[model samples]
Target: MTAAPNTTKPSGQDSPSTDTAVLRALRRIRVPQTQRNRELFLLIFAFLVNGSAIALVQLGTMGAIDAAFLFYCGALIVLVLAMHIVLRLFARDADPFVLPIATILTGLGIAMIYRIDIAVELGGWDAYSTKQLAWAAIAIVGAIAIVILLRNYRVLFRYTYIFGLAGIVLLILPIIPGLGTDANADVWVSLGFFSFQPGELAKISLAIFFAGYLVRTRESLTAVGTRFLGMTWPRARELGPLLVIWLISLGIIVLQRDLGTGLLIFGMFVAMLYVATGKTSWVIIGVVLAAAGAFLASRVLPYVGGRFSNWLDAFNPEVIDRAGGSYQLVQGIFGLAQGGLVGTGLGQGRPYITPLSQSDYILASLGEELGLIGVFAILCLYMVFTSRGIRIGLAGQDDFGKLLATGLSFTIALQVFIMVGGVTRIIPLTGLTTPFLAAGGSSLVANWLIVALLLRISDAVRSRPRVVIG
Candidate 1:
C-alpha cells in the first residue's frame, strides 16, 4: 500500500484571503536565431553572386579564369563571413538584409576593380584591386569589432559635444600643414605611411553628435516657431544651430575645397533636424541655405565653377580640352551609352577607358559592363538598404537611437545620391566617392562603421524586454 502525499498550493496569487499578484512571462520581439538564420541564407546568395561576377569578369576579359582573382574572392568572403559570425554571436537580433547587402555591393566593387586592373594590365600587390581587398578586410574587421563591442548604441549620447568637436577637427585635418595632402580637394590627411580622407569619418561623428544634440533640444526647436509661408519657421535663436552648421559646410567648400563632403555634412544635419522636429520649415530653410551656399561657392571657388562647367558642357570640345576638363565625365557617359540596356558583359566593355574608373567613376564602370538594367538594380539595392535603415530607426523606442539611425541612414542615401547623381550628370560631380561600389579605403571603413552601428541599434530594438501576452 502506497501512502498519499499532501501538497499545498502556492499562496501569493489566487489565494482567497491574500492580495493577488500579477504574473507575466518574459517575451522577445523575435526569436534571435530567426534573424541570424535569415542573414546566413542571404549571405550565401551574396557570396555566389560576388563569385559569379568575378568569374564573368575573368572569362570576358582574360579568356580564362584567373586563380589569383579567385584567391582574392576567397579572401574577401572570409572577411565577410567573419563579420557574419560576429553578428551571429553578438547581434542575433540584428537586421538580416543589411550585412548581405553591404557584402554584395562591396564584393561587386572588388570584382569590377579587378576587371579594370586586368584591362589595364596591372597585377601583383600593387594592383588597385588588391589594395581595395586589403581595405575591405580592414573595414570588415572594424565592423566586426564594432558589432561585438558596442552592445548599447545609446552610450554615445553621453559624449555628444565631444563627437561634434571631433567632427570639426576631422573636417579641418586636411588644412593642417604636414598632415594635409595637396589633392584637388583638401579632404585627405596623410601620416607619412598612410593617408585617408578625414571627412569620411567626420560624417559619422557628426551624425552621432547631431542625433544626441537634437534629442536634447528638439522641444525648444519645435515649440517656438513663427508661422510663415504656410510653414512654421524657427525663431532667430533656433536658427543659430542651423546657421552654425551652414557656415561649417561653406567652410568645407571654401577652405577645405570639398564641396561634396560639405554638402553631405550639411544635408545630413538638415535631414536629422527634420526627423527630430517633424517640421517642413527646417527642410525649406536647409534647401534655401544650401542653394545660396552653392551659388556663392560657384562664384568664389574655381573648382566649383569647373565642376559645373564640366557637368553642363561635358561634350563640348572646349570644356573637354581645359586643364580640369569634362573629358572623364564625357567618357563615363559614353561608357554607359555603350552599355545600353544590357551591359557589354563585364570585361568585354572597356571600363578602364575612364580615369579613376575604379574610384570616383566606378558606377560608370559597372554601368558600362552591366548596362542600364544593372545600374537600375544597384539603385534598387540602395533603396532597399536605406529603407531598412529608416525602418530600423522608426522601430526604435528611444529618441537618440531613432535620430542616430536615421541620420546614419540619410548619410548613406545622400552620399550615393551625390556621387551617382554627379556621375550621371544629374548634379555637378563632387569629390564624393560611390559608397561601397567605389575604391576608397576611408569610405569603406567609415561606411562599415555605419552598418555596424545600425545593426547594433536594430538588435537592441528587437531585444528590448516585453511582457508576454496570451
Candidate 2:
C-alpha cells in the first residue's frame, strides 16, 4: 500500500544514515587506539630520559661509560618494553600517563642511587644502585603479572573481609620473633636472604578492604550524623570503627615504633572515610584524635618525643649535639639551601653528605643536585601522577572504584607531603620512603602494584559505553 501511494523512505537519506553510523563506530574504535599510541610515545621519551641520566652519572662519576651500566640500562629498557606490551594487550584503554611518570621517577631514583654508590665506592652486586636496578626489574615484572592476572578491579571487592584479615596478618608479621628484622624502623620482615616491609603490602590490602567496606556502609554512615559548628559529625556509636583503626594505628606506632607507617595507614583511612561519608566532622574528629595521639605519643614514646623536640629546636646547639638529634634534619636543610635555584648539576652536588640519602632523604638529595627548579620539576611529576589518579577515581563508574582510587592517590600525596615537609623543616621527620624515588624493594614493589591497579581501573572506566538519554 505504501509503494502504491509512493510514500516509501528515500534510499539517498538511508545511505547518509548508514554512513553516519559507520563513522561513529570508527571514531569509537580509534579513540582508544590513538590513546595507546600516545602512551607508547610518552614511554619512549621516558626511557630516553632515564637512559641519559644513567649515562650522565657514568660520565660525571668515572669520566667514562661502563659496559656493565649499559647492560643494566638495556635490561631495564627491555623489561619496560615488555610491560608496555602487556599494557597494550590487557589494558588498551588505560591512562597513558601513569606508567611513563612512574618510569621517569624510578629512573631518576636509580641514577641518583648509582651516583651515591659511586661516591661511596660500592661495586658489583653489593652496590645499592645495582640492587635498586634489580628491584626495578622485579617490580616491573610484578606489575606485569598484576595487569595480566587481575583483569577486573571489581573482583577485589568480593573478598573484602579476607583482604582486611590479610592486612592484619601482614602488619603483625614484623612483630613475630624470628620473622621480623629490625632496620631503621621495626617494619621489616626477613626471610633468608630476602627482607621485606609487610607494612607496605598491608597498606594496599587495607585500601581495598576500606574501599569495599565503605561502599557497603556509606549509606548508614551518612544517614544519621549530627550537625555541629557548621559540620556533620558521626555519633559515638558510629565512631566505633574509626576508634578501632586509631587504636590499631597507635599499636603500630608503639609496638613497631613506626610512626610514619602508622600515620600513613590511619590518615589514609580517615581521608577515605571522609570521602565516603561526605562529613567534615570526621575530619575534625580525625584531627583532634591525631593531635591527642601525638601529644600522648610525645609524652610517653621516647622516639616521638625526640622527633618533636628536633622539629621545634632544630637549630639549638644542645638539640643538635644530642644523639639522634636534629643533625640529619639540619643537614637536609643545608643541602636544599646549597641547591639554590638551579641545583648543583646532578653529579656535582654533595647529596651523599645527607644521612640515608638514597632512601628517606632522597628528596633532599634530588634538591641538592637538581636545584629548586629541578626539585619543583620532580614534585610536578608527583603532582601530575596524583592528579591523574584522582581523575580516574572521579571518572569511575562504581563507588568502590572511586573510593579505592581516591584513597590510593591520597596515600601517595600524603606520604610525599610528609617526606618533603620533614626534609624542608616544615614538620618533624618520619621514616617514609619517597615512592618511586626511594631505594627500597618493598616500596618499589607496592608502588608498581598500585600503578597496575590504577591502570586496570582506568581501562574499565574508559571502555564502558556512555548512555545519552533523551
Which residue ranges in model 2 land beyond 4 Å of their true spot? Answer: 1-14, 465-470
Q: Residues 121-205, candidate 2: write the lDDT tens digits.
A: 9989898888999999999999999999998999999999999999999999988999988575689999999899999999999
For residue 194, what is the lDDT in candidate 1? 79
lDDT per residue as tens, model 1, 253-335: 99988889989999999999999999989999999999999998898888898888898888899999888899899999999
TM-score, every prediction: 0.93, 0.96
Instruction: Note the residue pairs that clash in candidate 2.
Output: 343-371
Steric overlap count per candidate? 1, 1
lDDT for model 2 comes to 0.90
